[model samples]
Target chain A: MSGKPVIVFDKVSLYVEGRRFLDRADLVVSEGESLVVAGAGGCGKSFVLRLILGLPGMGRASVRVEGDVVVDGHSILAEPLPALQRRRRNMGSVMSGGGLIENMDVRKNIALPLNYHYGNVMSTAEIEARCDAILGDMELEELALPGRRPVSLNRMERIYVALARALVNQPNILLIDEPTTGVSAAAGERLARFCFYYRPEFPSAPAAMEEMSGRPMTRIITTVELEPYLDFGHRFALLANGKIEEIGDREAVLGSADPNVRELLSRSRKVASPGVDDADSAELPPGGGSCWRRSDSHWCHQGDRVKEGEEGASGRTAQAR
Target chain B: MTALIGPIQGLGAQVCEAFTNAWSLLMFSVDSVAAVARFFSRQGFWAAFRVSLQQVHFTGLEALPFLSLLSLLIGFTVIVQSLPQLQGMGAHGLIGKILVISIVRELGPIVTAMIVITRSGTAMAAEMATNRISGQVEALEAMGIDVFHYLIAPRVIGSMVSLFCMVIYFDVIALVGGFLVASTQLTMPWILYSDYILESLQPLDLYISLSKSILFGFVITLFSCYHGLRAKRAPYEVPMVARSGVIQAMFFVFVSSAVISAVFYWI
Candidate 1:
């Protein structure tokens, strides 16, 4: 919490296909604190990740980055692709839907970033050793082998493999999107714990490897669900209708007058309460009441989904607001 | 008046889009050239070397049989279509000269380019587009790998080398096919036909043929990469870009062939 800011989005606006996706958004995350950006579907969470990654130029439509996005105290938009790519390496991303390169097997997918960064300098044996250590830390020794294809793996296995790939390079900033969409609730909570406090401290790992992985990282994670991540982060940012509606310490914002914030909290309460039915959950948006907080760091399942609890929760939250 | 304004505005937008596409294509070309130069140092020599070898296999070796077949068919058709008129005029001696001029100097390069455009160029565009949509391209960029150097430069260089080799293959098959047909049907001597064909093939013709093949190869790969990069972030855009990429590549091939042919033959 005492570290300097690692990421800064200053009045950034993004317009895609003649429709504004993000409007003058601003946010800052200090080193070593995970910031969860919660928003509904189509609320620019994905665009925010792409924008910070400086991906506006790669698409067909004209991309205009109106303001500054500084990561590690440098202007990412001002730099070109090759330069931007180098800067991007300092950050790791677990893409939505697990963007494993289909052509490469699980081991190669994990080894790709390392090979890219250290291919020129490191010996092949050294790279393999690093990859082995990373695999061990993620506890993926048995399920994923060097030759196992990504498609052959189950959903939870893919998420774990993707997590290994994102952490392989020991990036200073880790970006994850919708980390719990396809996995069991228990698996989701375990993955979230790893994201929050991952340090490569395996006994078999080399000292230098430990040193590289032990550095403080600034993590930025985006999810549609609020309860699973409610008390997991030092700060929270709520995005609604193409704008950051609220951003503050978790408790303050939870208790804020913002209608969106109140709605999110009440939705969390409904999800946490037992006996919610699927029919009610179907009416809400994706990740609406399907997740809730168990304690300070763990996420627990409340119901199959919110069914009868939807109307009651809405009425209660509206009265509270 | 409103109708006229709407049409005018649409036309203006089209013109603007055309210029923008042209500019983007030019920039992509420059970036690709730079990536090629930087490949050895930035991407490492062995990685680029392996990719180049793979491309040679994909674009050249795998395409050999098809190119050979097409060239043979064209050679046979041209000779057969002209056989009656040449026999009546007692002008069998000119058959070799016609083959060398039409098949070797022109058809060999253009046909090879066309086949390559249809096969490898479209595949490369679709592959790149799929990679883009599937987040593989972004993954590469995120990992600090230069997508241009890693994905594009090797393919372009590989296609150029492959097209250059295929032109030789096309020329040999066409001329040999024409020679066999002439010898059997027209009772022409092998030594005489060879001598006549060799005599007709000027150094300029050889230069033009090789140059055209290389230029066509470069244009096709460039257009494919440009269009593939232009594809929007949707699965449907993959096919759309692939189709447009093929069209643009063919258009450039024909246009460049005309310009080069005019400069060599007419000018």
Candidate 2:
């Protein structure tokens, strides 16, 4: 069971606008293994995730999730709607903005996955108790009430709510995009530690729900750059254009002088590099997440927009828009 | 004549496409209705209905003041034109009858339909377009929630109810406006106005007018939702959908009003 691959993208390729986005991407991950697939934006980082997620039937490529994507020992493509829903319950994905429902307050939105997946498994008392513990654990003491809608809260608060919602199900797999891209470096480190540290603290949570699906022991396979934004992934796979060039530890992927790997890294730096985008360059705070300004009464974004660094300043990228 | 036949035939084909698309949309609406009924138990029908009511308030009530003002100007202008013509024959007393017939039998429904089409109709389309763009529609779908019921059924119901109420409001204002103009500008006697209005206006006229508005309400909601829900995922598509909604609503109302008038006359 440990050797069984949870997700396997077999020689998959995707094309958009009649031009190939990803030529052929082949990758595999087994239970209890954490991984980070890193590449420049538009270099098919999301394309890889999309195939594993089965967003489209075939994006000019064949995709197969070998062991189980949504549940244990079952192919995601073959599962029924109800079965697929059950699989999705075992996992949750968080985009950079956290995709909070604008109308529902933070608390209700966070409570959603709990109600969807485990309402019957956990009693009313246990559910409330668990929710309370998590809120305190994340230090979201004030936001636990979910009083205000998403629009009112600052960006970091929204990320806190987003992180809280992802953890509500105590999922086996968390597919996250740009986890640290919007928050302060300190907060990003805290988020990275929280996700990486989950393996040890809540080891029992995933096993308890193992009977619902085949795989358990909540493992996170995500995508990120370890040198700057985060530091704790077990594996980093080099992705360039639309293919995985190398798969190894951080030292190997980073230290390697492979032409393709060097090219991919060089290209990633250029994406946010103001030299190419100097036409509309703004001052960015030395560390990147989201760059915006907010006073008590004013939220003006004038001059060169540099990513700001502060407790709440980092995660407000989505809101600053 | 041959050139005329080609375009006329093409128009017949396009109208047929509208009918076919409408039928497809009706089937989709039925599916959503069933899904919404299922979720009704989760958040009681009254609560869901209340949310829908809020949609109407934002979508409907906000536009009423301007619509009423337009109706007033239309009524005053129409009566001004009618007075000189009616007076030429020494039948100036017919002013009230003319106003009543024009306002209730024709202008009320047409104007109401146009307003709903421009305002609520475009609003619904843009909202759905944005929902599609923001992945809200997909979010609803992923929850095993039928989008038609949760996203669209509410708007359809809201548009129908809102359009009807607005038309009634528009009709009332137009009448008062016509009366105010006749009394002040024409120095017409109150008895003449009242007698003419009472003698010419019928319950059937009001019923027919209201009924046409209901049909207008249905068409506006249908066209807007159909185009909006089927929006492209691109950013600019939302604006495109909104523009197309206005055009489609106008086309639908024109055909619907003509058919409705023909039917009323035949009956």
Candidate 3:
């Protein structure tokens, strides 16, 4: 984590349906840092991401937000719609269902942001080249056919396409919302792996390209299932009951004194080592613990199948490897 | 007293909500127009222009055959039904006046608008509602593409342009159909019948029809786009909004037709 903060939530509170979805939530995410927000279902994890993106419902009237949310050095709430949209150009969001436009084919969906922002400045060849680089980087070139709609791709491919779309603009801040929520566990593992892929390089327009090209990206990912997100970045904020129950280095939060934080870690461990009782899963695996889930007498972690006897409970953690 | 107050409050709330919705629709239509203006000056003008052309092709060109056929039928029926009475009374000269004053001035714009409301207006509403339901609208906005510019403007401008052209086409076709049918019965030369029709067709009638068509197009596009954009997230809302949009568009078309015709003819 760097010394400077790139994203800050200064006592931000969001009220929805006369209930506080996020109240006085405060956190600082440094530039180039990735923070995995872990919480129970409906803990406003996605809501916070929406707030950061300045989506329509995250405002004074609808969600009734209070306090300030500053992203990439500007108050998101203060900016008007167009200004917010301009600011959002630097932020890439992979919303649920990949937020791909069903009307557009896969290639157009990926190129939508590029065509919107730099359509005037960049040539068709340049835009295509950029899009090709992103697809190649995301390993989604197989589905980049000219006329292929989003429905043609399965759940996992859609998520990948969404990520590719988000990253096509080379946004500095990547806000991913539950990329693996509805996919098979195997696909979820692949999605987890795809989230960490490198941004592609291009020699096109230097202004939008330079800011995100060499600089380390700051990613804030929210997920319902914490197992897939366990290894993301170095920092973790445990959000529960519309508040950050615990926030610090991943290790510190994992071992925090807050019961909710401890419980969440334990729950994630349970997801990783399913079929094993809580007593047997006591020792937390070291260095970005394995996201392996034991199902039907085999260990599945990152698509590798290991028999239970050969890879005992202690040897299952393979995310860092 | 309590019962009266309850009913009164409920009515007041309903009125307020309706007024708010109307105001929001107006504002959204205005914003769409402004975005279209901006679209003209910006680099995206060509893309938006292409979309507008496609819309015009869909709403106007593709609709040409059906609209022309309907106009012809209408003109034939009006002339056929009224010719006997006029001939019985020896008022054959008034046939051109009747055709010009009725079909060209009144029926042409209103019927064309009704067709548009059924075809493009409902489709626009459904499409807009689908965009909202499927998250395409939000997705566009999130990508920094203005929803008004990218989605609504082209449809509005295209439909308006298409309606104007359709009205003119309908007028011409209807008059031709009336002339063809009247020639068989009246025993008049083609040139004299054409002259009578052309002479009765005052420039003021054309002006009124053209203005009404433009207004109808604007109203239909505005209402459909507004309703579609405002649809709830539920799947059922898509059909509901389309239905409501069509109904409202038709209502506005009829009312505008009456108001515009009265102002142009009666006043």
Candidate 4:
């Protein structure tokens, strides 16, 4: 990770409906780094992403922020609407459950940002070309046809489309919330890879990653389950009791004392070791390949199920390192 | 004293709530006007203009047939009722004056506004509420697109244009239809009828009718959008907001039209 900080959460606290959701949380993510924040369901995991985007929470309850959230050296809480809009232009966000416009089809949804921002400068053909390129990169060219609204797509397809929309702008920073919520574990891994890494096999992969400054896109991904992002994230943080209990490198987070952290680690371990817990391994399909494997000095996992024995799982983990 | 205290407290609370709502609505109106100015001055003019055109098509064009029928019926009724009464009073020459005063100055703008409120105003509110509940509005904000520029401004402009055009259409159909229907009963020349209406019509009458149309348009749309966006997230809130929007828009259209008429004619 680079030393230049792209996002800084300086002792931030958020209260909704007179109840504390975040308590003096401090997080600093540098340029070109991906941070995975893991928490249980309803623990305000999505709220963090909304906070970065300067959005109100889901319901009508009043929300109050006690501390500053600085993104790209600008204090988002203090900025005017126009300044915030300008800042948002440089950042891409994938909301939970794929917040696509319902009336517009998939093509229009993805083309929205480009059309709104560059419609005056770029021709319609050029705009469509950029949208087509991003859709191709996300392997969603088939769904790019008109009349394919978000409601028509499955969860995985919707998330992929949301990703394509987020990346079409070539934003410098990306904020994703629960990308792998309802999809299978294998699909989740692929989605995570698409967010963080650029594969050479995809023709427009460079277009997705190519910012104006030529630096890697900074990403902050929030998930309820840690297994999906374990391989790709540069650092991991455990959120519990309205605070980030543990945040560090993957090894440091894995070795932290937080019970939530421990539970997630144990759950990941069970997924990595198949026969060790047959009950948990049920999520793995019968003819599926081994979920856990060694790849590029990382523990790349397919499914969130534990399949092999502890010895085999540890051996793979050791090899992965 | 204790019993009176409870009632007084409740009344005070209601008053406070009313004031709060009024203040909120006033602020929203100011923000909406400012957003329109900013939208025109900004970069996404054509994109937002396309949305404005679509709104015009939906709000103005689609309602044309219904408006035409209603205007013709109203025109025939007014002329049929008033011409005989004027002839009996030996004031047959006042046909044009009566038509201009009743239809052009009042009924044309008010009735057209009522139709738009029933049709387009409710739709705008419900659509905006649904978009909010579905997270589309939040998504638009996250994408750096101004909600006011893309959504509110287009709807406001479209409603104003639609109401203005519809009022004129209503007035013409009412006058012409009234004259045609009355001619069958009274044996009056078409030229005489036409001359009477043209003579009775004044620039002041036109100004009042057009002003009411534009004001009614602005009030209806602004109220609908304000109520619709008040919906936070729940699915059930959609209908509730839509109903509130329609009620408030109707109320404001009546009140504002009355106030404007009173200012122009009575005061």
Candidate 5:
């Protein structure tokens, strides 16, 4: 991970109905790094993203926050409205259930940020071109048709449109909440690629780590399941008991002894490695090791550990040849 | 003594809550004004302008037919009933003054505001509440879009403009209806009726009518938005917020209209 910290959570604690949802959680995500925060459902994983955005409430109930979330060298909690808005402009967020504007069609919804921020400087044709490019990259051309409002789209389509809208501005930071929930396995892989190694030119081809040129986009994704994002993210953190309990490199996280982390790892492995009937296959690779399969045609066994030099600079493990 | 203390404490709490709400509403208005100013200086001018035009279309142009019908009925009823009485009392010359006082100065603005409150005001509240409940407001904020600039300001501007135009339309249509009734029933000359009405018309009457309409517009839209945003979540809260907004906006519209008229006429 790079030393430059782009987002820092300093002793951030949140309380809802006197229950501790976050207990002085501290995290630091650097520029061009991908961090996946996984937890059980309703475990306040989404709240962390909200806290980073300096939002006061979750859905309806207001959460009392007692710490600072600093983004791009500005404390979001203390920054004034205008400055905070400017800060948010540099970051893109996808809230749960894909918070697309109901009244606007999918195209308008995706074009909103661009139109609002760059409408004066950019022509309408330029804006439409940008929207069209992002829609194409996200494979959302069909949904971009006029009159396809949020209500008309299903859950997966809504999330995809929301992701497209967030990325249309080419935001430096992307905060996505549960992008793969209730989605098919193939769709989940596409979403993972979009969040991690997105390439506009080859939408279907797997994006190699070396192919991503320039400064990488910082991504902080929260999910109830971690299988989809296992191949991505520089670091994986498990949020349990209102605090980030275990966080480290993929191997370190895979070898953690925390019961909660073990359960999450086991669940993720079970989901990722389908058609395996052996109960031992569902459990974590024995001896604090990690196992991953790139395709169903080939299965890496428990002892097939990744060598130190084999890991990519972007923290991605070597692909199975 | 304890019973009295308990009741007094409850009263104190209620008063405090009322003051808190009033303070919040005042701050919201100030913020909305500031946002409107910022909206002009910032980007996205045309986008927000489009929303404002849509609001104007809904609140003003669409309500024209119903407003016209109601205005005519009111005008005919007033002239049909009051013209004979004035004639019997040898007060035919006072017809213009009476029409100006009752229809132009009072009923036109109030009835127009009532129609707005029923149609546009409730719809705005419900729409805002739905936006809030459905996470659209949060989405906008996340996108760095100001809710006041994009949503509230357009509605406020549209509602005010709509009320102003509707009041003027209501007055003119009602007067025409009055003239029709006077000419048909009493065989009054068109020249005589027009002369009486023109002679009685005053700048002060127009000022009061237009002022009340604008103020009513501000009060109704502000209250509706304020109450609508009060619903933080829950779909059920949308209707409740809309209902409360309508009641509060109607109450304030009446109170402000009365206060403005009393201040102008008496104090």
Candidate 6:
């Protein structure tokens, strides 16, 4: 870990309507370390991420985010509401559904947090450039509107736009929800790996960076994903029933005989690994989410059975290398 | 370090949004009306009253000159058009009385409502629509400001006060116009015109017009405010709400005007 633990969830327990969501969960996400949380649906994967993101605090009291979620030595749980919100500006969040405003045009939607939170000091022209720069990174310069409606964009397009908004500020930590559920597995894995590819955006507008008040750095505090969706992580953690059952390097986690972790990975509705884009099962063959596609078998097209990277399906790379 | 980018600018934009929203709120009768109930329900009377005064000034007071001009034309046209008919029937002496009845009983109330509808009615609908889409309504709640008290009540009060003043203004202008046109265009002596005015209207005619204006004002403001407060979620809902506010406001104005006219006739 490059720095002391940025977010620590110590003995946190959460229950909703009598269903135990998170039970005495203890977790630590360090700065710049990618801690992938792997679990099946309803296995409290999202709950773990939300805990670190501080989502539960909006309503309940029993579900406590204990320990210290200290970012750069500032503990959020200790700060006042206003101060916490101010600190929240350093953290970027994109919910699984890509919480894009459907009514607003793309440019306006992305610009909202920046414009609204920043106020009006940056002129329209300057803000537009910031949006344009982020749009370029995803090679989505033509696929979307900087100022068009969210509903008009495709699912993946919406996801990228959501990502663009989240990363635009180059925040201290990013808390992302399900990014692989709706899109193709190849596309999904690439989306997660894309984070590994982006370096610090140093050469852009200094005016925007001035607002951030520190060295230009991009960090990934943690990622909540199931075993099937785990792509690139320094370590993987098993989140079962609100508590992290086991956390270790990939080999250790894979080798552990913990029934809780094995049952989670085995019985879990296994999704394809985002890192491996096998070509045999790419295509859907007209109308099928067939067994192969359903259970970790990567496909090229919707059902074509050809190479998964048929040059245009977003998984345009050899996986078995 | 990154949080303080556009502090001054963001606040400026919010203020801009607020004022524009307020301006639109005053433009429609329904919005103004809802703003009334919203005011009392949310804000104490004192705060609402001050906002109402501001609304009255912008919506009703500012509209006076135009209302006066329209009313004057109605008055002159009534005398001129009716003069030929009355003179042909050898009832030329009754021009004054006809002018008085038309101006006081019909033209005054209807014209005032029309002006208020065109100006204020549309404004409120647009404001409400914008607030719905922009999350300004939510911002209000977060800030401990009651959207109803802060936005709607004052509008209703303002619309009523403005509409009332407009009716009076329209009535006076029409009477003056009628007298000027009758004496000059008809070449009738001043004494004849004066006598005609006295003969055409009963004192009760003034009461009927005032009552009609009050009813129209209330209905117009109520409906406008209602539409504004009920802004829907969709973007398309905004224009729809605005159109509905004006249509509903005008409908009530006509209905009230007719009812008041009927009561005057029976009396």
Model 5 chain A is weakest, by summed lDDT over 10 consecutive residues, at A201-210
Estimate the TM-score of every prediction.
0.81, 0.66, 0.86, 0.88, 0.87, 0.51
Runs of candidate 1 with Cα error greater than 4 angstroms are A21-23, A56-58, A139-155, A199-214, A241-259, A265-321, B1-6, B44-49, B83-85, B89-92, B186-193
Which of the two, 1 or 3, has more TM-score? 3
Question: lDDT per prediction?
Answer: 0.73, 0.61, 0.76, 0.78, 0.78, 0.61
- Model 2, B6-88: lDDT tens digits are 99999999999989877977776566556456645443244345556876886679888888799999888888788778778
Which structure among the candidates has the greatest DockQ? 4
Residue A13 deviation, candidate 1, in Å? 3.5
TM-score of chain B of each: 0.96, 0.83, 0.96, 0.96, 0.95, 0.77
TM-score of 1: 0.81
Predicted complexes: DockQ each: 0.34, 0.05, 0.37, 0.58, 0.50, 0.04
DockQ of candidate 2 compared with the true complex: 0.05
RMSD of each predicted structure: 8.6, 10.3, 6.3, 6.6, 7.1, 15.2
Clash counts per candidate, in order, are 3, 15, 0, 5, 0, 55
Tens digits of lDDT, candidate 2, A1-321 = 245677766566666545565656666766655667777665656555544444432211333333223334566656665556556665656654666767677776676555444554555555556566556656565775646677777776776676667666666666666666555544554465445433212323434455533344333333445443224555667677667765576567678887655654453321342122322222222221112244332232323343344415433431222
Worst 10 residues of 6 chain B by lDDT: B138-147
- The model with the greater lDDT, 2 or 6, is 2
State the lDDT of candidate 4 residue by residue for A108-132, as single tens digits.
8888887888777667877688777
The regions of model 2 sitting more than 4 angstroms off are A1-13, A21-33, A51-54, A57-90, A100-137, A140-158, A167-173, A182-184, A195-224, A228-231, A234-321, B1-51, B73-100, B134-145, B179-211, B225-238
Q: What is the interface RMSD of each candidate, in Å?
A: 2.2, 5.8, 3.1, 1.4, 1.6, 10.6
Interface RMSD of 5: 1.6
lDDT of 4 by residue, B1-267 (tens): 999999999999999999999998999899889877786878778878888888889888999999999999999998888877887898878888988988999899999999999999999999999888888888899999999989898889889999999999999898888878768877789899889889999899899899889888888889999998888889899899999999998888888878888998899
The list of candidate 6 runs beyond 4 A from truth reads A15-20, A57-78, A119-121, A196-202, A205-231, A263-321, B1-267
Candidate 6's fnat?
Answer: 0.00
